[model samples]
Target: SEQTNKHLYLFEVLVKNIDINRNLLNDYEKDLVIKNPIRVRIIFSDFYDVEIDEVKDCKSIHLPEPEQVKCHSKMSRTATKEKNGKEKPKQPKQKQKVPEEMMYVKKTSLHSQKAGFSCLFPMEPMEMLEKLKTSSLYFLIFSNMGEDEAKKIIGQAKVDVRKNFIDSVQYASATGEFPTTANLTTSCKIENVFKEVSGRIEVYVRLSCFGKFIMSMFNMLYNERNPANKKTDEEEKKAETTS
Candidate 1:
């Protein structure tokens, strides 16, 4: 029932707007896009492994808010200081990692209203779905749902939303022919492959390359920020001291 809800709500939402949000494009955006428009990301993040057990109160939804696109317009990524109040290291790397923060889809594009939307870009890749898959996340963990053509589609669509919404979007077709459902399936797989290796997207190939509805995997707590979900490090440390 929860999975059904997510499919209905959050996933469908991202499918529609991630490609283009009307609010992000104004007369100014529309005007500049005609000339030197491009997408901008205010946030840069590192990936870390998030176990299903470690996940906290990150908001899960069946659909994305069309309005959140506007809210993020004023959003800026501030590099948080370490708990010790020290600067973070530059070029940190791990053999494997999950994302440090729950990624928000925001992009600022320099393109036009006619060319289409302007908004914050998705900041990172690989760690989102790749983490989910790599860790084999089990949020009620259903499986063998009868030949999931939808699974791959849902997974891949999120990547498109992240890339296209964040960067730039352009549409084209090859050899001037209508592609088919099978074609779409193949496209999803291909995109996943490209994205996995380089964390880069092949958007020109993705425009009409896949499914009608995007997959939204919204359900469950996401981060540790909510008071309900949070246990401050100091409290934990104090407990350790008493114990």
Candidate 2:
């Protein structure tokens, strides 16, 4: 059976590994020993006129101060080499740990209505994919909220959805591969999608689609099996009867 009101595409964006270049900052900003909170905004643009905006609070994520690594002197290196009779291999530096709050997750959905929904007929997956190819994602970074509560733009980045996600699905579909299911319940993750930004902002985006039928069945089964939901429904019914 055909299902209605299901999203053709769903994207989950995870923003992390955000490193702001202090050298890129203005002299006034660089002089400050302590900087203000940094804020991140995500925007998803499709073929439609409307763009989805996901804005996060300034204080939500706290960027940690950069670590200072001490350099070994030549004398120390020579002494170590002489003691061992050979130069020691360099140890790899460990990656910095990102805070839980610093990682932001945003979900965006593209529906058939946005592509041109019709009451008489359902939209096809191919048509939806065609429309999705033109979509793109935008990332904007800001530093230091002013007294008037305005964001100071620092850097920005853009990513094409087709290159990052849609094209891969199309290829998988054309090849009759098991990677993509019949219902298009497939997902792909992309890292470092941002480009042409002043500072480095690492991001991961996961694109997926679940047919309406599958989602509807899952919801129905979950409602039937959950006792807490049944109790709430019964309570609501009793309250209505009493009224």
Candidate 3:
């Protein structure tokens, strides 16, 4: 009875972004895990990204969960005069965007851990370790990038990546930190937007090709505290009764 209060180890997760472009999805190229307590947010990039009819334009997917994301944005530095007051041309600042046009949100969440991580997003470390031996896992990812760029990224990337099916992806930018305003140091920023294919048929396809095998680990010993789960088989019942 005391064990039912415990929670299972959640690993599988899915993150979905509304009105996101095919290019800006970093989740596509990396080996991200989908652990427990996952959250997913869907954003709308301007009115343009929204669909007129809910049937085709609605953005949703049943993908694996993404791992805990430690989002970090450093202060975008600008060109400045040194202590000598020498004019230093600004380093082409990696443009920070506060793109209003593409306002969107991403949805992320976690699920039950069923199989080995190697089977899902196998990479170097995951492969070397036997699937059952290791508790580690990796997940596949999808992007809103154009077919050409998505294809190229998938082609060059070691892991699996791709666009959704029959989907015509459109290119648009959400409003964010423009990196320039009245010569004042532009505060770097970001935005929200969805994606669509330009034209033709683009069926949503999932590829289980590759990824980075960060580690081979076992579920923490403390995770399986629930007596109900621990006693899923009958031998445990006898042990429990004897105890």
* Per-prediction TM-score: 0.16, 0.44, 0.19
| Model 2: per-residue Cα lDDT over 210-236, one tens digit each | 444444555457669997875775687
Number of backbone clashes in candidate 2 = 0
Candidate 1, 76: how far from true, in Å? Answer: 39
Worst 10 residues of 3 by lDDT: 165-174
Per-model CA lDDT versus the true structure? 0.24, 0.42, 0.23
Model 2 residue runs over 4 Å out of place are: 1-10, 31-34, 46-131, 144-147, 168-197, 216-243
| After superposition, candidate 1 runs with Cα above 4 Å error | 1-24, 40-130, 133-243
Report the number of the highest-lDDT candidate: 2
Residue-wise lDDT of candidate 1 within 179-243, one digit each (tens)?
22111111112122234321122211112221112222121232134544235544665887999
Scored against the true structure, residue 238 in model 2 reaches a CA lDDT of 93
Query: Which pairs of residues collide in candidate 2?
Result: none
| Displacement of the residue 55 alpha carbon in candidate 3, Å | 29
